[model samples]
Target: MPYFSRLQERPKIISKLYSNVITFLTYIVTPVLLFVILFAEEIVIVLFDTSYSNIAVLIQILSVLGLLKSFSNIGGNVLIALGKFKVGFYWNLIWSLVLTLTLLVSLQYNINLTEFTLVVFFANFASFFVWHGIILKYINIPYINLTLRFSLVFVLSFLFVYLLKSFIMFWPSQWPQSIMLGTYFSLLVLVTAYFTLLLLKNQKTIIFTLWK
Candidate 1:
């Protein structure tokens, strides 16, 4: 949070910070999100056994907020630095109220956890847009570019997952083995996204730069 204050004295740092933050969120955090989303069963079963199996769904639900939470957290720091603390407070309040009301209704109606999970997702999803708007307004980030970059990472993560699935087919079907293989593939996704972005954004080829 304090690092954001230094950004005022050096306005250009905003772009750098945005770039680094997004890259970390994309290539680093995103694969973990995708992995957890896709392999919640394996993860929970392997880590905690079938006794607590119900938690897998809840974990998946909460993990959906990974990206949104990342953006909101960073935005919170930025807001505080800019002394736009009230805006952050209000947005958070709104989301909290939404979740609280929805949760109360769910409890009253005996809603399933899946339904409750969707409610949680929606609250975070909606609050993200509000925080994102603040980012565009105060942080000077262009929404178009940011959206495109995030979308690019999103697309590539799915692609990598698909490819990794094919390779994982040859591996043993044991839960522990599957988890290990999935992690290796997850790391590959990060590497592939990193280099792919470099090529797209900088027009820099890896070893293939030779014949050009």
Candidate 2:
């Protein structure tokens, strides 16, 4: 009977784990897609032959912002999972406040849209880290270990993408826009595939044990 109970619980455990994973992925992807869409105009302007100084500044700001946002997302998910509903709500509220304040300050200083957006991004990122810390504390999880693992994956994937982009830069200037876009996407796909394979290889031993 005890063995049967354990067997019965396995399906439920698996189902819940699957659901949480799906929810987390959805949360991460949706905001990213929305951010891209919302900033499309700024992105297009930057992509064209614009002032490299401003573009460089914008990129630097946005990159840090992006990192922060990613951290926040993971932190938020952890908070929700740990059953700290009030803490999560307050964290989100604080994030909104930070965004609003940053926007106001940026406007006051006459910052460009791209720069302003980057400020917003960093603000959100900070909020996410704060919330993440809170969630980890609540759940008694090791924050350093998880953060280092994610950082390793992120850096590796970014290097792959950077190299692919550099290679694309050497293509003919007269290449059709469609071709350029296709090449860009193909490279992205290849990078993703490479990363996926890397992840699988890294986890192979654990996966084999589970299957056996």
Q: Model 2 compared with the native: what TM-score? A: 0.59
| Leading candidate by TM-score | 1
lDDT of 1 by residue, 1-212 (tens): 66666566554565456555655566567766776776677677777788877888888888878767875677776667666789888877887888798778777877787887887788678768867876678667655776787788778776776566556666655656556755765687668676757744663222232233
- TM-score of every prediction relative to native: 0.76, 0.59
Runs in model 1 lying further than 4 Å from the true structure: 9-12, 50-55, 170-179, 182-212
lDDT of 2 at 74: 48
Cα lDDT tens digits, model 2, 1-212, are: 22222333354333333233333333333333333333333444446644443454455556555655544554444444444557878867876787787788789988877767766766666666576567556554544655565556555555654554556467545866446655655655565555555644665322343454
Window of ten residues with lowest summed lDDT in model 2 = 1-10
Error of 1 at 207 (Å): 26
Mark the 10 consecutive residues where model 1 has the least summed lDDT.
203-212
